[model samples]
Target: MADIRRRKFVAVLGGMTVAWPLVTRAQQPVKKIGFLSVSSPGAHAPFVAAFNEGLKEVGFLEGQNLAVEYAWAEGNFDRLATLAAGLIHNRVDVIAAMSGDVSIRAAIKASSTIPVVFISGSDPVQTGLVASLARPAMSPASA
Candidate 1:
């Protein structure tokens, strides 16, 4: 009877040891990212798909461990700032500014602290997005 009880206890302890990490991971909060764009959803469908694929490559999946909040200006340049502000209000971990420098600027303006990742055709240095490409002043290392 003593041996049987010891065996059962050992088995339960082993099971819990194997499952503990998974349980803790599940209890951890999901990461949230804001997708801010100056174009319509339909127009930027391919870009969004690519972005999601990139996220998957980096071990992040939408609605799984990560949540994406999308804000589109629908070609209205004047609405970029408002949309960016809305994303900031949503409390995203980071803002992905898509479409152009305008969207990037809007996201940067929305929150000074929140990190903004941008896709721009123009020179970011000339646009004042970064001090230099080799040493981006926005990063802590440069600061």
Candidate 2:
């Protein structure tokens, strides 16, 4: 009887240990990301699909563990600032500014705290995005 009780207790403890991490992970809040682009929806479709695929590869799925808010300037340079501000107002955890330096500049100007990632063809340092290539002086690391 003692051996059977010990075995059961050990099994229960092991099961709980195995399940604890999963429980904690499930309880975690969903991450929110802001995708800011200067191009129209039709032009940005492929990039958006690729971004979603990358996120899925890392175990993040839209409407599940992650939520993405897309803000497009629709090729209007004047609207970039407003769109970036809207993303900040939505309380996005991170901003992905795509297309060019204008989108990145808008996102940076919108918020000083929120991290901004940019995809620019020009040199980031020369574009005033970061202080240096090694240690970026901005919100967070840009890639």
Candidate 3:
């Protein structure tokens, strides 16, 4: 019985491998990511620079290699929608829209196809930013 199960598993795995290329080819290309925040350009410059440094540590760089878009609201929650919409319009791969629940909601409302990562202080699930705290929907970056 074990041998039969093992054979079946191997067959399924082999079939999946054979079908992988077809699915991979249908996938889209690499995308630019957008960072939406209310921090002033100067206020967030260091953080951005730090992020670039971290990326470089892992073999990535901005402008020369990676593309990053910034949509700063300059300290106003009301402006989040406009900035988030702009990122969605740009077809950004993802939006790193860190604020509270409101900002996350704004970004999500602006676009569904493009992924959004919301960094918040409270229980993400309770705030409804995530479906559940333990097993919320996640992307590679957010995961």
The candidate scoring highest on lDDT is: 2
In order, the Cα lDDT scores of the candidates are 0.86, 0.88, 0.74
Report residue 63 deviation for candidate 3 (angstroms): 1.1
Task: Looking at model 3, report the run of 10 residues with the lowest lDDT sum.
Answer: 134-143
- The number of the candidate with the highest TM-score is 1
- What lDDT does candidate 2 reach at residue 110? 89
Q: How close is candidate 1 to the true structure, as a TM-score?
A: 0.84
Pairwise lDDT winner, candidates 1 and 2: 2
Please, what are the lDDT tens digits per residue for candidate 1 over residues 24-89? 977778888999998999999999999999999998988879999999999999998899889888
For candidate 1, the 10 contiguous residues with the lowest summed lDDT are 134-143
Q: For candidate 2, what is the lDDT?
A: 0.88
TM-scores, one per candidate: 0.84, 0.78, 0.67
Clash number for every model?
0, 0, 0
Compared with the true structure, what per-residue lDDT tens digits does model 2 show for residues 89-127? 999999999998888888888888898887779888876
**Where is model 1 more than 4 Å wrong at Cα?**
138-143
Q: Which ten residues in a row have the lowest lDDT in candidate 2?
A: 134-143
